[model samples]
Every structure is written in structure tokens, then in C-alpha cells.
Target: MFLRRLLPLSRRLFSSNSSNDPASIIAELNKEMESVFGEPPSSTHPNSIDNNVMAAQDSQSVSPKIVENDYGLTHVGSKGEAQMVDVSPKENTKRVAVATCKVILGRKVFDLVSANQMAKGNVLSVAKIAGINGAKQTSNLIPLCHNIKLTHVRVDLSLNRNDCSVEIEGEAASTGKTGVEMEAMTAVSVAGLTVYDMCKAASKDIQITDVRLEHKSGGKSGDWSREE
Candidate 1:
């Protein structure tokens, strides 16, 4: 790229070499300088990069972007570092969250599970218990999450014959500075894992999928629900 630009200027300068005046030669050299390194920028030019080292130092000195509260990443600090949020100053409010997941069992495995004929005993009952326990121990499982007292937690499982899957739903409620969204999500995830563990012997192809939060309410962000 530099050679391409320099060649054009060199051709023009050589063509004008017939004018042997000292002032004319100096003018040609200045033009070459301007062509090689772009015209000098004004000191106040907002986007100037004339002083590359100074420009880079200015970029490095720029403050980090502030994260606003429209569901921004609260776990990150102002210095662009990962950190847990401090909920000490926030008001304690009643919060509720619901999460769900699906476990796909093949036709034969689904039949066996539905009939409670698996060697693992009652799959749904055990998964439900696991989900409840998971909700209670969510803080231990996830990093940077606050351990808040939960008011209630419930796990429900339903068999979807049409899809040959078991739908697991978990709801968590708490009256604290933080919401129970993680707890609810953890509950659904653990319950799905429990289902997979108990049924893996019968079918290795069993899949757990579509784990998501379906609803949440009673927080500074207000309420939100997934559109059906």
C-alpha cells in the first residue's frame, strides 16, 4: 500500500525535475512528506491520531462503560471485572420464579418409566425430591449467587405422551433482597439430571432439553413471563 502511493508521487516529482530551483525542490519534498504521512492534524480534532502514542494512552485512560439497570449484568464491577453484587442496600421484596425443562425418553423407555417398571423405582418421585433439594442448595451450586431463605419451593412433573417426554417444572419463592430465579432454574436442571441418571441404564439416548425460566415476579424489575 505504501509503495503504491509512493510510486505515483515519485513519478510526478521526477517529471518536474526539469525545474532545478532550490525552492521548487523543497516544495516537492514537502508534498512527498504529506503524501507518505497524511496532512498534519489539528490538536483539537476529536478523532485525530497524529500523536499515536498519546492517542493510545488516552484510549487506555478512558473510563469503563457504566452498566445501567435495564436487566444489565449486575455481577460485573465498574472496572470491567467479574464480581458478585452487593444486595445489602437493596430492599427485601417477595420474589417468585418458575423454571422448566424436558427429558426425552424413547418409546420403550417412556413406557417403562410411565409404568414404574424401571429397576430404579419411582423416577418421578425421586426427581421431585431432588429438585426441591436443588432449589434449597442453589447458592452452593452456583458462584456469585446470594443465599437467601426461600419461602416455598415446588416441583411438578408431567408425562407428555405425544412427545414421549417428561416435563419438569419448578417454582421457587423468597422474601429477600435477591430473586429466586437461579434457584428455580437449578431445581429444573437437577431434576432433569436425576431423571437422566435413573433412566440411563435403560436408554443411553435419553435427552434432557429446553431448560428455561417460564415466569418471574415481585422484584425491582417487576414481572416477566415467556410468551407461549
Candidate 2:
């Protein structure tokens, strides 16, 4: 490719023979090239090609920006592979997270659960237990979650007559290098699932929705909360 592009310019420069000065010849050659090719191609010479390749390799050598947040999937290695985060270097600190979810049970199932008439037993009590257990076992459930000792776990369930749903709130606290966001979320999720399992007999149309972290505190990123 280099030879093909250079052949025309070489013929035109030597044919002119107007000046034997190497500097002037080189400058004319460059002007002719720009007129014919508009821009220099990367394959102009072996050294230019090597320089471009080196520049690309240098860019790849730089560590990529990795953002850890609710909108991004983290826990990645240098080679873009999945890997667990290492928090061993971090200092232990108190962390707290709150998560919430809602289980839509319809009017009939909601009333039954509210009145403690479900055949599977008291829905709220069993779900609360399940939520606490789930918070403790968060590391086992999530592949990349750290197994930190939880200081406390609380699960609250309330009947929402307006929506005919059970609102579940889970709170988890820990003194560890990593935050307990996943644990709190796991608690709310498990509680919602237990609510469905206990009341599925009454209505299979039950839905679990709005599972999300409401607030998190005491991390390197500081604190965060949902906007209303």
C-alpha cells in the first residue's frame, strides 16, 4: 500500500528536476502528497506504523475507569473479567443500609394475611424471620458479597389498605470494610418472597415489586439516599 501511494509522488518529484536540494525536494514531496491524498495514511512507513501501534498499546496499558454505583455492574478485574473486590486493606467502619419492597396480595389475600387467617401461618411473623435470616446469609446468596458480621438486622411489614399490599422494610447494620447494602436488599427480597409463598394459595396473581435500596451510610463514598 505504501509503495502504491508513494510511486505517483516519487515520479512527479524526480521528473521536475527543478532543484537538487534535499530539503526543498522533501518539502515539495510533502505538498504533493497532501494535494493527492488529502491526509497522510497510517501505513506511510514502517516507523509511522510502529509508532501508531505503540500509541494504541500505551492507551490500553492505562487502567480503565471503573464506576461502582447502582447504575453500574462492578467487581471486575483488569482484564475485564469477573472478580470479587478485595476489601482487606480497608479499615473496619460502621455501615448501615435500608431497603424496601412491596408485595401486592390483592384485597382478599391482603385481608386474610392482615387478619392472621392464612393457612401457612402468620404471614408477617414468618416473613420477618425469613428476612433476618436472609440478611445474615447474604454472602452465601450473592456470589461476590463479603461475609461480614452483621451487628443487627430488622424487618418490618405493614399492610397498605390503599394498595392491598404488604410493605416490607429491611435494615442491616455492620462494622466491616464493606457496606451492607446487599444484605439489606436481600432481606427485603426474602421477606417479599415469603409473603408470596404464604399467600399464593389465595391468589397466584400476587406481585413483588419496588425492591430497592432506600439509603446507605458509612462507606468510602459517604452516604446516599433516594430522592423522595
Candidate 3:
């Protein structure tokens, strides 16, 4: 929720609902900046090649040097500083990411949901809408994420009788400098949460599990897909 959207006086009214507070928005933007620029190439070394053997080796292989920024802590700098990644130099490309989640429910609850028999109405229908809304709200919720123009967002929900569960999948696509993995994951999260919130009346034992990125494509790192 964004204050700009919540307290909109003009055309930008009520945008980014997840960032409803001003202080939070500033903090989020600052955090994102720190994450983006936290790392730089520590050093550049020319490679020596043996023409005959066609071998190449790094000249600065052993000297103590600043290590590359770890993905686990992209927000922290080599010197323990925070920075915003400069995306101006990055080329915009079509990026897509998919995430999945499973919601396990009791037999009674599962049957009720699959048949849309719950008093709360169509669970999957509401969840799909919630998932899309969640994807749109990802930037606002995440502290270090850019407000991306989403080209496409799709959320699928299927009742799995064999597993006594509901399978949820969310796919997000954008043509931008960064990937949309968070958006996809957020979609699945909200969809699963919606199911819990809606079906809690039926049973409180519902479990959400295996929330993870299933696939991603585009960007400099290329593509990745989870195995099983």
C-alpha cells in the first residue's frame, strides 16, 4: 500500500496499495538502491594465453582481492556498505518467472473447495484474482524491488484429489532490466493465503508448502528450471 495511492490528490490516486506509508516507501526504495549497487567488479585481470596450447590463465589468481557480492546478501557492500544497483547500464529484456505452491487440506475441505461448495463462494476464482492482485502489489510489499510494468500475469489453481491438496501456479512476465521472480512467488503466496483465509471456516488444518520458484527465463543469467 502506497501513501501516494492511498492519499492520492490527482491521477496517481491510490496506487501501490502495499506501500501505503510514506516512511515505508522511502525505506523500500533506499533498500533497493543499496541492493542494486552493493557490488562492483573488484578487479580486472588480463588473461595470458599460450598460443600453441590454447591455454588461458588469470594473472591475479592468488592475491587478496575484494570478493564478488554474494547473491544471498546483495544489499551489503564489500566494505559493509549498502548501495542501490544502477540499472541504467542494464539492457531491458523480456523476463519471465514462474512459482508454485501447494495447499493441503482435509478430505472434507478439499471436496468442498473442488465442488465450490464452501459458503465463502468459489475458492479458486477468488484465489486467482487475489494472486493477480498480489503480483501487482509485489513491488510495494518488497523492500528492494522496482515498480515493474507487468506485461502478463497468470495464476492457475487446480484441485488435486490424489494428494488432498490444491496446486497453485503463478507466472509473471515483464520486459525490464530485472527478473520478476518475486512477483511470481508473491502471486503463489497470496493465492495460497487466500485459500487459507477463505477455507479456515471449514478447517484450520490447511497447510501451505513447497512455495518456490519453478522456472525463470531471460535476463543476463539466462534461464533456470527446478528439477522435480
Candidate 4:
């Protein structure tokens, strides 16, 4: 809870050679922490704890008992209560995320969308516009989501005549402190829902499934892509 930052020693903490003398490493860390926040309990003997044990303890404790809360569930408090994470300290980074969803149109619905003969109008076009709007209004739709200005949002919907299905892909880009995975996913989901709404008259049982984040890039953590 305190602002006693020791970011200067972040690299040292993780890079320390535990194979040579893990106990010594933890002891050194304990000494440094003691200087900042006082000593540990007399019952906690040095030999009783090691790197992994200390890490678990540090991850769970979050108050005067802890000098540095390295990592944990950011959206939850130490007491397991819900709370928003403070992302202000993190540097702004260009963030991009891509998500995909599949809408399996029944025979009648597929014909309507593929032929652009839906009674509600151009099903794919309306879904595209709805997806863009969904990306922009992500913070409003989801609880505890930050309001971020997206630099770009692209929603693409393609119909596959072979399988009578539509594939929806949404990509959201933002130059901010947080990734846009949620926005991308929400866009795809909303677009798929839009398709269902527009074409439900043709087939009420049209299936929408397999919505997932396909890729994410930027931010402090760097780039990541799904294996499949």
C-alpha cells in the first residue's frame, strides 16, 4: 500500500542466482526489506522459507507486513474484494488486439445474408457499423473498464458459402497504458449478435459461437499470438 518503490532493484531481484545460494538470496532480500519496514516475526526462521515460499507470501500479503507487492490479481484487493487497478504509473504504449467470432447461419439465414436479401437490410454492413460502435463504447458496456480513445478499429465479416457460416474479425488499436483485447472481443461479439438480430426472421436457431482473442501486441508485456 505504501509508495516505497525500489524499481531500481527490480532486475536484481529476478536475476539473482538461486541455484548457487537461494537462502542467501532470500536473506539479502529480507535484510533490505527489514531496513525499509522493520523485521519479520521471530517465529519465521530463515531456514523455514525459500524463494518460492517467500514469493507466495509476498503475493498474498498486502500492507505494512509487505515492503513490495510484486504481483497478484490487479482487479481484486488483498481481502478478495473487487477493485480497479491503478494503471497511471505504467507508461503509455501503443496497444493493439484482434478478436474473432463465428456465426453459423442456418440454411435460410445463410441464403439471405449471402445474397444481400435480408429484410432488415445489408446484414453484414449493419453488423460492421455496430462492431465499430461497440469498440468505441467498450468502457460503458463492461464494468471497471477504462475509457480509452481507440486510434483505429476494423471489423471485417466474411461469409463462407461452403459451410454456410460467417467469420467476424475485429481489430482495435490504442496508444495508451492498457491493451485493447476487451474492445476487440466486444466488437466481434456485438457484430455477431447484430447478424443474429438482422437475420433471425429467416432462421431463429442460427448459432453464434467461438468468440476469442486471436492476438495482442504492445504494452509493457510485449507481443503475443495464439498458437491456433
Candidate 5:
């Protein structure tokens, strides 16, 4: 039981293959002695069995690197088809995702929306509603997306007059097998598009950019957040 408790720690401190090699195991023990006593082992040392045990302990301390391969489909097949991820056997779990998008419009268009002078009427409110609707319908728009029930969806919009841009944020939550990252991203994208549709009459220079997932939680790999 004590050996089991110390095994993981030992593996982290020595070379990766030291545990399998007798000579390397002995060297590891000698190195630990040098560290603890600040001196080399004596040539006349008579306790061979103790020395071997110490060597094994030292060998167990080496650290190993974890390597993972990219599983995403990056190339089209011979028949011009894309590969989809297989999640058939994965257990269902709760998941949430958040994403953001920015729409940069001309100063005139921004001012028109801000002042409620656009002929379309209530650009921000319409976009927010569209975003929520989009979140609910994301699986329909994107192929291979699992159609799971969304427990909640929220969309927030902010105006940056100084930069003539509208920032859109979307959040989606679900209790199912897959994550909602794509849904959140799709919400922001559709919302930005709606803004462009409503305000296009005011200015034709609107540009939607930076549609991306901000954070996600729950799943086998655990949680993740994109760096700012």
C-alpha cells in the first residue's frame, strides 16, 4: 500500500525508462542520495539489497509526457465527403457554451441604429430575438450537430460607438450527450447577420467578424476557456 502511494510520485521524478532498466535504476538511487546527503555513495558500500531497493524507488520518479492526436477531419475524402465524429456510445451529460461576434459597421449606420432612425425599426431588439431563436435551431443549420434540448439561451448586445462596432454575445445550455459550443457560435453569427439585414439600408459597409466559442463546460475532456 505504501509502495502504491509513492509509485506515481517516483515516476514523475526520474527518466521515463529508468523503471525498466537495472543500471538506470541504480543510477537514479545514487542521484537521490547525492541530493539528500550532498555526497557521493562510497565504493566500499556493502548493503547490496538496500542499494537495489533504493535504485528502484529512484527509477519510479521519472515523469512521462502525454501525447494526443488531432481527431478532427481536415481533408475531404475521395468522394468529396467529410468525416463526422462518432458519439454514439458517449454517456449523456450537462453542457454549456458561450460565444461572441463583432459586427463593424460604418459610422453613419451605427448612428442610425443608436438613434432609432432606421426604417426597419429596433435593430438591437430584433437581433437579440434572432440570436435566441438561432440558438434553439442550431442543429438544423449545421450538419452532424446533435439536436438536444436547450435549457436556457441568452443574447446580449453592446455598442462601441468609438469604433463603430456592435458586439454580440450568446450563451447556450443543455443537458445531453454533446456540448453547445456550436449552438452559441451559431447564435452570434445569426444575430450579427440579422443586424446587417436591418441596418443594410443605412450603410452597405457592415462586416461581421470573430464568431468563436468563448468557453465550454462538461464532457470527457472537461472544461475549457479561450485566452483573450
Candidate 6:
């Protein structure tokens, strides 16, 4: 009876040590993986574990592709089918996005906006308000967008006397699951529209151009910046 109890205790101690051992744990994990996958994992490169993990993540992640639309809006689609990205499993991170738009107004409209002679109000102030509001309402305005919390939205308008144009720049920041790229773009678009509305009496030939993402930071894919 005494020997039997000691045998059991010795076996228990050996089992616990084996289970806690790194080599034994690795072997057990390999067996488990083989049982599930029906094959042993290849050991191609030891340092490629992170790369493999990233590749697996990329395979499971939702990415966007460009497609043409009737309203001249470029959208993300796959195999001729429009799809919204699912960001459910992504981590929340601090993100900042910036966009710019240029409205090429003729001399008359440019002068009116620059001189603050518009009948409605100050063109820059009204446009700034509109841009901020548009940034907040980005998800509501754009279809299939996820509502996200925004931290800040800023709009800046500048007049180029030599080119006879007005440039609108928008920046949006957030700490959330998704980026504020759409918000920045929407702000720039709305600001340009507001400018056009304020100066339409002077000229109707204003052209909005280059509404695009300038820079973005944070998220899994890392930072991006447009080339000047």
C-alpha cells in the first residue's frame, strides 16, 4: 500500500514536469495541430513565424478594391459586387487622416471669395463649419459606412492669387476601430461645395479637383502618405 501511493505520486510529479517542459509542450502542440490539420506543419524558416502569422491574418482580413460607379464615385468591390469592409475583429487604435481639395474658380469668383464680398456670409467661415459638420456626419452621408467616434476635425481654406483658385484641406482624428479617411474626404468635399454655393453668383465654372487622402496613421497596415 505504501509503495502504491508513492508510485502514483512519483508519476504525478513526472507528468507535471513533462507538461511544463518547453520541448514537451511544443511536441504536444505539434501533435494537436497534426490531429486537426492531418499533417505536420512545415519548418521552412524559423524566423518566418511572424511572417506566417501576418500572411494568415491577411488572408482572413477584409481589404478594399476599386470599382467604377455611375456617380463617378470609386468604390470597393470584389468580382463586380460591392462590399463593405467588416472591421469587427480589428483592434481600436488612434488614427488621423488628412485630405485636400482644390476649387479652380475664375477671376470673378476668386475675387469675391477672397474679398469676403459674398452676400450670404463669410465664405471661409461658412465653409469651415460645413466641413466640420460633414466630417461628423460621414457615416450618415456615405452608404455602408460604420459609425465611428471622432476626436477632432479641422478645415483650412487658402486662396492662391497667382492660380486664381481656392484650396480646402481637411484633417480628422479618431481613436477607434476604423480610420477617418472618409471623414477627411467628406470634409474637403463639403467645404468645396460650400465655396461653390457662396460664389455661384459670380461664376459657374468652378472645378473641384484632387479630393484625396493625403496622409493617415495608425492601424494594422501602418501609416500611409501621398507623394507630392
Best by TM-score: 1
Q: Could you tell which candidate, 4 or 6, scores higher by TM-score?
A: 4
The regions of model 1 sitting more than 4 angstroms off are: 1-63, 66-71
lDDT of 5 by residue, 109-151 (tens): 9888889888999999999999999998987998778788999
Q: Which tens-of-lDDT digit does each residue in 29-110 have in candidate 2?
A: 7876786668776557869878999999988886465322333455866556678998989888899999999999998998
lDDT of 4 by residue, 35-131 (tens): 6788666886666778768888877775632333335656766666678778999899999999999999977788878889989999999999999
Cα-based lDDT for every prediction? 0.90, 0.91, 0.85, 0.87, 0.84, 0.84
Q: For each candidate, how many residue pairs have backbone atoms clashing (under 3 Å)?
A: 0, 0, 15, 0, 9, 0
Q: How well does candidate 6 score on lDDT at residue 66?
A: 24
Q: Which ten residues in a row have the lowest lDDT in candidate 1?
A: 63-72
Candidate ranking under lDDT, highest first, comes to 2, 1, 4, 3, 6, 5
Worst 10 residues of 6 by lDDT: 65-74
Clashing pairs in 2: none
- Cα lDDT tens digits, model 3, 1-228, are 344433433234236675588786766565554455654444643332244234323434532234445454656656657765556788999999999999998899999987889999999999999999999999799877878999999999999889899999999999999889999999999999999988999999999999999999998999999997
User: How many residue pairs of model 1 clash at the backbone?
Assistant: 0
Worst 10 residues of 5 by lDDT: 63-72
Count of backbone collisions within predicted model 4:
0
Per-residue lDDT for 1-228 in model 1, tens only? 767876776677677657677677678777777877888876686645558768888778864463333346888666656788998998989999999999999899899999999898899999999999999999898988898999999999989999999999999999989999999999999999999998999999999999999999987899999999
Task: State every prediction's TM-score relative to the real structure.
Answer: 0.74, 0.72, 0.68, 0.69, 0.65, 0.65
